[model samples]
Target: IAARLVISQRTAQGHVEHILSKLGFTSRAQVAAWVVEERQSSS
Candidate 1:
């Protein structure tokens, strides 16, 4: 989301952390996979 939003790398990292905490995910890879799955489903 931060990448798409054109935010800095550090900001993106922060967003990833927040997302992981909110979603109960332990890894950024899991969050990335979820984002991909979500986009595919929405499309």
Candidate 2:
């Protein structure tokens, strides 16, 4: 996914860390679950 975005892996990882910290999430799974729930609700 980072490659596809044309960003370095480290950059992508940093972005993920920033997102997790801002959202108060401990893991990617929690973020993914929240995204899915949000999408479902919007639809």
Candidate 3:
């Protein structure tokens, strides 16, 4: 993921933290599940 994003490890970590906070989720797994559900509903 870091190679694809072309960002440093620290930057990736910060992005993950921001994403979690923005989505009101405390766990990465929860965010992943929500994203999946969203995509499914949209499709």
In order, candidate lDDTs are 0.88, 0.94, 0.90
Error of 2 at 37 (Å): 6.7
Candidate 1 on 1-43: residue-level lDDT in tens?
6668899888988877887899999897887899999999999
For lDDT, the strongest prediction is 2
Worst 10 residues of 1 by lDDT: 1-10
Model 2: per-residue Cα lDDT over 1-43, one tens digit each: 7999999999999998998999999899998999999999999
Better of 2 and 3 by lDDT: 2
Off by over 4 Å in 3: 35-43
RMSD of 3: 2.6
- Listed in order, each prediction's TM-score against the native is 0.52, 0.64, 0.62
| Position 24, candidate 1: lDDT | 95
- For residues 1-43, what per-residue lDDT tens digits would candidate 3 score against the true structure? 6678999889998888898999899889998899899999999
- Candidate 2: where are CA atoms >4 Å away? 33-43
Candidate 3 lDDT:
0.90
